[model samples]
Target: MTRTRKAMVLGAAALVSALTLAGCSPAAQNDDSSNATTYTQDEIDKALSTPTELTFWTWVPDVQKEVDLFEAKYPNIKVTVVNTTGGTQQYPKLRAAIKAGEGAPDVAQIEYQYLSSFRQTGSLSDLTQFGADEHKSDYVDWIWNQVADDKGVWAVPQDSGPMGNLYRTDIWAAAGLEGPPSTWDEFAEQAAEIRSKTDSYIADLPGNDPGQMMGLFWQAGAKPFSYDGDKTVSINLNSPEATKVVAFWQDLIQKDLVATDPDFADEWYQGLARGKYASWQVAAWGPLFLQGTAKDTSGLWNAAKLPQWNAGEDVSGNWGGSTDAVLAGSDNQIAAYELAKFINTDEESALLLANDQFLFPTTTATLKNPDFVDQESEFYGGQKVNEFFAGVSTTVDKDFQWLPFMDFVYSSYNETVGAAISDKADMVSALDDWQNAVQEYATQQGFTVQ
Candidate 1:
């Protein structure tokens, strides 16, 4: 999602030189140039005689089907895909590629979290001038907003991870709870009862993972930043809603009602499978991970709405997912736009939905499709998970935007906050350190930190 822009700069310089030379020639520069450049059917046929090759980089496992389809449709265009390895490593690699000025790929999969950072680099092509406007109505407003810069649209939203609670039904039943808790209070009560009655903890609080905690804050209507146009104003992390939410999470751990585990280890996956943890606060992608990690648990798991902040409706959170962006230096801008449109629009919705790709399509028409509504999954006892996810998607807020420094901030916050949860640091000091570290990082990244 992030690029160095060194390659883009060099490419721009070369283009400027070419344009300048062409302009100097009397025959090359003329008022009738636009008219003369129009390609006839014969000319178009000649152009298609030689295929254009494009390189695509993506992290999504479901992208293969789309790639195959695209190759089939445009035999003249060769599409080569490279799978991304790590989420954090993606941006840095992109940055380095741009710096090297030679290894940059034609198209890259960019996650929503890193979109702001990518846009700030000014290396991505704005698809608006190249026919993206025609498909504007096809995507959700919020998803479109994620890719739009002040100049124009930067990417196509391929998919999103709508929030949900994936829990073990057997564990809830054992705790004397009939169904998933609807409110935070009910969730807390159930957690307490579950802890007292059963050996399994209600959830695992991996202190290093700030995603669940951030989700809790957003569900309580707290935002880390407020934007007016392009300017951003930092919001108080100690706001009443944030404090209450933090306290709720802290109290669960402090009261021994939730299992505190180390982040990203064999123990975490093993614990989840053995029902040492009862539920997970995750997005639609949770089922995919569960399918691989908890295969033995089979029919024991089910999906539910995330717990509301104070027993109200409309409670959900956005998590990890990638979008596609075209580079500004691309020679085949029109071709790139066409491919982007094909994936994000209605063309691939059925395949995306059927594959359990966790792609909650942004297009409203795609949502209205019977294929989306009638979709059934054997994973959750054939309960029509897509319908449940569609309901959650409506609550996503357009105003919620991530900061360019989110990666830096979140990385530091997790470390500091994790220490606090592990009893190695106090909450007040940890939060103070987290804020100071983020501000310093922002400064280092050339931001005017206040």
Candidate 2:
């Protein structure tokens, strides 16, 4: 069946009254009668005694294995797994379920990009009372902060899409470059050399992707938006840092050293597989897409740290990733928290890495484990890819924050800014239009846009 149909079917089966409990903490399930306000153990036992079931929604392929394990350990608790389709479709379903008030999943996987929006809508449960306090020591401070608000926590840290550069060794070798470039200047020099020495392009720059520009801007410490708990501030896209990033990309295109692909289509995928482009900027989960789309280039690919800015330190940034959150309305909040905690912590992280090659857990302890260091990936020339990623994860900046109107900002920015890159519009004009559009869109969404 189609992915959407599967999601609908699972959502239907898991929406029954007994399974309709909203958000609570994993600790709530273990509480005694004395702490009944927080869902004491007696209440959970009574609820479970009657064969309580929970619905879980996720898009990650690795989560299925964990669900199977969770089921085996708790045979009495039934779980229905729903795999949501595109982000555009998934959010509406969640919104509808929240509105209906009785059919939402006990837990749902949400992207970091949407955390602020979800929290604003009051769809998630406060996890602070669920015992996240004690376990907070186990996670990275930045990750914990990602899901927490002034009131309480919304979700447990799952995986991180720590950014890196994936390159084709063969392509670099053919271009007479010794290795991947380490700094922005070096990268530009090498790209020019590669174009001059060979027929292949250095990389595929999707002109329509503001996210790519955002990553570059982030490397220079520019944030699209900032929050002061009560108000949001917009960073000017015409700022020097943003201009530098856009200028560099424009030069690359003008020099004809990079291919200006509109999006990740068959042509782009095939080009990567055939070594037409030497490298691409990606995050931890990107390997999965490469594995599925470029099966033929198994051992040719390898990953390295992204090139540093001319004046910045050589640190990595994050791209895209999802986190798991318990619903405020879930009846089995305690049980759900337990599952969320286990999956996000060190032990389950190692298991996830071993089982699915793509997941890079955010827990520092998991990264330090021998299993993480020793594991080898055949797809990456038998490299201990996880170990390298683990070493880099610690240095990733946690200060990078997401805004409530990120979806609207990114969608509009990409389309407009992308037009400039494609030579369809003037850069200044495009950016001005983008900024105005974002302000208007955010205002419509009830956000105080500047």
Candidate 3:
């Protein structure tokens, strides 16, 4: 799940500040030749050798280990690491700094959903100018598209969270199930059996996680939100595809086959330990998180593909992951880009990010490396968790897109659709409320709602 930062409902004053700051930043004047800018090996070496200090903003703990590798390679370059909090707290501060034309970091951690939001401000530097395209084939396609577009490459893919199912084998066995469900119809039958025989709910569908719910929509090929990278966007949250997804969950919830609980809380954590949840319909990060939070469950669990809407279709979506992006206002673009690229692509740094930090691998080299993916996890009965997730990552759709106002989009879900889930009310009506609320917000933000 995308971590929610604590903040009161953003008022109109804050929205106005953001809108004004977005408009005030200078637009990049790009020529055809500018888009094709590339650095030769000698030129890159020269730039890395020059004395420079790059300020990087991120919340990943102990990322200094990766930065140190970059510094070791380019002894003349020093990076100042700053944890300006994450998404919610960081965006306002970054916007203020950009408006003041001072104090913004040279590089920052930006999640895929928010890339377009930052791009709207005209603040992110085009990384294609720094030769980012040269490494395009190194990353997973969905992740590469998150940071690059027809306009420019915005950042390098650092990590990703492809959706999958992590379930308890023991629970399914007790329910007389032979294997994981391949289709949603089979999943519903298993959910009913598990609840009746094993006394365990199939999963905890969070009452508040729009990102997770949206990931399911994505897996079903619902193009609910689309942005044109300009002022025009298409918002269709209540589409037929979206309704089918919601209705299926509504049936399960109403039948008591699934638990409606807030995730990432102590209660949810305890649910895993106590065997209250039979499975978690979560992202690639869920396996590692489960190992850390519910160590007692050790050998009882296993990984599988998400239950398909169409029996044989292989498809999934992302929930949480981020990239390191350089700002347009940075005077040290070349040095900053080098620092961003080094930590994610260099063998030593990439391995550290995967094994040490437990961020899912994005680079194909790291994904294929046996040392990275074949290692046994004691928590999952020596299962090669990374290998399973790496295989699942290949099923993610490459064409999914996001609206620029994801912050608002998510918060609105918690207020409207999430509220409905908690009340066990009509979810179809809730979807309509969500659609209207999003459309109104987009229009208010000066976006031409399509």
Model 2 per-residue lDDT tens digits across residues 1-450: 233443454454355323546432233322232221344456455555556588888777656677767667667777788888545667778878988898888888887767777777777867765557656767666566677755677788777777788888887898898999888789899999889888788887786666666666666666666544345545466667667767676778877878887657878888877878888887776766786878888988898988888545777767666678888778787777766665666376445754474666766677677866687878889877778776666656667666766777777877788877676345656776877787777667666656
Lowest-sum lDDT 10-residue window in model 3: 1-10
How does each model score on TM-score?
Answer: 0.84, 0.84, 0.91
The digit string of per-residue lDDT tens for model 3 on 84-166 reads 76787888888899899999999998888888888888888888666677788999888888788887898878889999998
TM-score of model number 1: 0.84
Candidate 3 local distance difference test against the native = 0.86
lDDT values, one for every candidate: 0.70, 0.71, 0.86
Model 1 segments more than 4 A misplaced: 1-50, 149-151, 226-236, 353-358
Candidate 1 lDDT over 1-450, as tens digits, reads 012233344455566667778884333333222211223345444544457877777776767688777667778878778887656767888877876776666788888767667666656766665556556767666666667645567788777766788888888889888998898888899999899888899888787777666666666777765423233435355667766776777788888887778756799999988899999888766776776898888788888988887666876777666678886656665566556666666456434643556566667777677767687767677777777777777776665666675777678867787678766335555766776777666656666543
**Best-first order by TM-score:** 3, 1, 2
C-alpha lDDT of candidate 2 relative to the true structure? 0.71
Clashes of each: 1, 14, 1
Task: Score residue 199 of candidate 1 by CA lDDT.
Answer: 87
